[model samples]
Target: MVSIAQGTFRTVLLTPEGRLLDCRASSVLLPSHDGMIGILRNHAPMLCELQKGIIQVKNIPDRKNAYYLIDGGFARISLNHLTILAYEVITFEGMDREQAERTAALAKESVATKGSFVSNFDEEIDPDRAAFIVKLAHLSEIGND
Candidate 1:
């Protein structure tokens, strides 16, 4: 395995709503459909479907390591530029730790409620989605702090 520890790349994270993050990073780790994949500058061109999880941007020029929770999407990597087109994004921009904690609490409650309510035999809470939400909440709390 090759180790990528130097250089930078342009990273753009967007959703149907709007652009959530646009920055240059030294490295980025995203949750792919299969598992976590890390991208570094001059990486080989590739495209993959993203999973519901956290996206970590590391070694930014002018900010702390940033994190975003994505529901699902696709990532395109080419020529040292990585673009992420996500379906939904949960951000902690300007959110305080207290607020994030509350959001996490609400997410837990939602998961519990959905799991307990079994209305319509064909409809039930998706375990993957629920787990994703829980993970998102946890990430948000960490990011806010």
Candidate 2:
């Protein structure tokens, strides 16, 4: 694929807790409500509601791609500046990938356990939701894709 691949822009990532990262990136792949959406410099102005997935910031100078797992959020891209406002953000920076993978495995195992699904008057934990979360956790740590 031959992209004009021209230009760099600022990407600001913020959560309700605080700002996570602000840096220049050649492109950013977001976890939109529909699916992953990629933005590059000089892209059109747009806004998207996010979902459970990973945010990928690419082509950062002197660094590998940065990944963040977002629970839900809204993203805006305009005039070469991209901003992410997330309800929750779990960054992979300095994370122990092995531990994360193991934890996700345990979560999957628990979900698969026969008759292990639980519910309360206030909230119910369904097997399908548990499985989806486990999948997202696994993908967040994988970080390579």
Winner by lDDT: 1
Which sections of candidate 2 miss by over 4 Å?
A: 1-5, 107-145
Q: Report the lDDT tens digits of candidate 1 across residue range 51-105.
A: 8888988899988778887778999999988999997576666667666666555
* Candidate 2 structure quality by residue, lDDT tens digits, 61-114: 887778776778899988888999996555546657775555455557668783
Taken over the whole model, the C-alpha lDDT of each candidate is 0.75, 0.72
lDDT of 2 at 43: 86
- lDDT score, candidate 1: 0.75
